[model samples]
Target: MKTFARTMLAIVGGYVGTSAIIAALAGIAVAAGGMERSEAATLTSMLGFVIYLAVIIWSFADPALLRVALGLGAVSGLSYAVVLLLARAPV
Candidate 1:
């Protein structure tokens, strides 16, 4: 069903957006507060995933923006994954 697909897309978008925002914020907070690197990373990753899921569930009413949402979501997800991986290694 198209409606179902749209809903799923929207949810995914929301999740990705929320994940990126949460992760970035957490990273900033940890850096500013002088928290342990490992602790900060863990907290950030967890918070990102939780917030992402919550946002996706909450944004199920807007079907018109499904395609855009999906694209943005995928981009955000990929960006986060790449950035996180990069951060874990020496440049």
Candidate 2:
């Protein structure tokens, strides 16, 4: 049960964290290239999926690494949130 919770938390954290990173990058790309939101969302979703897989693989292979990974993932998510907000700020 504990392992399951850890895995679930990791998966969710990784997905959101990675998606935020991708979203920020996509936002920059959209601003520079004048891309549509739909296109940027699709690209971000794909990147998030890839990150999910990588994190899941690592989590299953090494349970002991879950704590560190989760901590780092949380930090990444927070940083991404800050970047997203800053990127969306009005000039």
What lDDT does model 2 reach? Answer: 0.70
lDDT of candidate 2 over 1-91, digit per residue (tens): 8787767766876666666667776776567667787997788768777876776676667657657476657767775876667577773
lDDT string, candidate 1, 36-63, tens digits = 7788778777777676666555455544
| Candidate that scores best on TM-score | 2
Error of 2 at 65 (Å): 2.5
Estimate every model's Cα lDDT from 0 to 1.
Answer: 0.65, 0.70
Report the error of model 1 at residue 80, Å. 8.2
Q: Candidate 2: TM-score?
A: 0.60
**Candidate 2: 10-residue stretch with minimal lDDT:** 63-72
Best by lDDT: 2
Clashing pairs in 1: none
Residue 84 lDDT in candidate 1:
88
